[model samples]
Target: MAQVANLFDIIHLNKKLADKHIAAEVHLRDACGRQTLWFELKDVEEDTLSRAQDVAISYFAGKGKPIEFDIAKGINFWIKQF
Candidate 1:
């Protein structure tokens, strides 16, 4: 079974990215000390959220990392594996 080693919330982000959109990076660590990166998009309209989710899901799925996201609140995240 897979296991999560760490969950990193985005406490800081690039100013350019933030100014462009509600986007940030979230990092995850796995049992073997491997790190995976994911993107977070907050306070988005429905259409934008949908597009972002689709792109994120596809990208992260290729990297073999599952995503945990909460749109209502700020981008606080957790890590889990199967």
Candidate 2:
């Protein structure tokens, strides 16, 4: 059940980030604290991406799940979450 919840959480976060035009790279960690999966974002804005990360964390945390997201530097982010 927990694994499924985590999986859905990852999926939901990914979709939300994508919709906001923020390129992201998702790395799912295993129960043993090892990375198990990786997702890379396509065309996106730097500012939107950064803000998206913050919003995502908050959105997920509100759902009783907190996620860690890192945005690479030198990227151009223009869009805001609103």
Candidate 3:
């Protein structure tokens, strides 16, 4: 499927419109069996909300979710968590 984004839509999205955009994105990802695992987002470095990801990392880390990144084995079959 084609991912479409345009400047006008991005610049004009209010709270309601932004929520619709997020819901649509979630529906599309769910339809394709894609999930947003926390491991994949713990390295976010965006300018505005980078600290938000840090907060999640600290929270999950306190709960002991793979609190390390020492993966050495290559994925022979499929991609698993680090």
Q: What is the C-alpha RMSD of each candidate to the true structure, in Å?
A: 7.1, 8.2, 13.2
Clash pairs, candidate 1, are none
TM-score of each: 0.37, 0.51, 0.28
Question: Candidate 2: RMSD over Cα atoms?
Answer: 8.2
Measured by TM-score, the strongest candidate is 2
Q: On lDDT, who's better, 1 or 3?
A: 1
User: In model 2, how large is the Cα lDDT of residue 29?
Assistant: 54
Give each model's whole-structure lDDT.
0.45, 0.51, 0.27
Q: Roughly what TM-score does model 2 have, to 2 decimal places?
A: 0.51
lDDT of each residue in 5-70, candidate 3, tens digit only: 233322432222234332211111122432222222222344312232233335334444422222
Candidate 2 regions exceeding 4 Å error are 1-5, 33-49, 67-82
Each model's total of backbone clashes: 0, 4, 0
Angstrom error of the Cα, residue 32, model 2: value is 1.6
Ranking by lDDT: 2, 1, 3
Q: Could you give candidate 2's per-residue lDDT for residues 1-82 as a string of tens digits?
A: 2322356766876777767656775546564423334445455544654565575656556776544433554222211211
